[model samples]
Target: MDCLFCKIAEKEIPSDLIHEDEFVVAFKDINPQAPVHFLIVPKIHIKSLDQISKEDNALISHIFNLIPKLANELGIENGYRVVNNCGPDGGQTVDHIHFHVLGKREMLWPPG
Candidate 1:
């Protein structure tokens, strides 16, 4: 119940938020890795991708659908990358599940 992302979702902590709905919230990453970098997180914390359950299908779909819409709004027509780090070894720094939207620059292969 003491999750950082949860606080952001609850508006308990201020963030550079771009989009917010009943299911998810999108905000600019504090430590941006590219020209355009942000995070889309579910309101309900599911730890990481591995924790997602069948009941979260609709929520997961909604987040994916919103990603491109947001990218277009940002004018990233060149290309973009949606990265999700599932676990610690996968480079997941946070325990909560979130998607990183990086664009406005060409993403190379073998992103590590």
Candidate 2:
């Protein structure tokens, strides 16, 4: 288990964690893209979203349910962006599933 996010979730690595439950954890991105940028990841190593199985439904729902609250807590209530890059062609760098919460600025369309 050399996964970075897994280490963070397990408290083996230090991260500016904002929220966490039995299922998922939210923390600030090491390299933020905006004034506020964070990531929500499942504690269980599920790889990418594309790799999610039907058995992960409940956990997935719970994680999704916490997204808005996480955004609001981070002060992005006015508006924010949630991005899930699935695979290489989709710009996914890490081999784990994560939701990127970005805000604190007006986002441009068609992300260049």
Candidate with maximal lDDT: 1
Error of 2 at 50 (Å): 1.0
lDDT of 2: 0.89
Cα shift from native, residue 34, model 1 (Å): 0.9
lDDT of 2 at 10: 96
**Can you write out model 1's per-residue Cα lDDT over 1-112, one digit (the tens) per residue?**
8899999999999999999999999999999989999999999988999999999999999999999999999888998999999898999888999999999998888885
List CA RMSD, all candidates. Answer: 0.7, 1.1
Clashing pairs in 1: none
Which residues of candidate 1, in runs, are more than 4 Å off?
Answer: none
> Which whole-number lDDT from 0 to 100 does residue 3 have in model 2?
92
Q: Rate the local accuracy (lDDT) of all candidates.
A: 0.95, 0.89
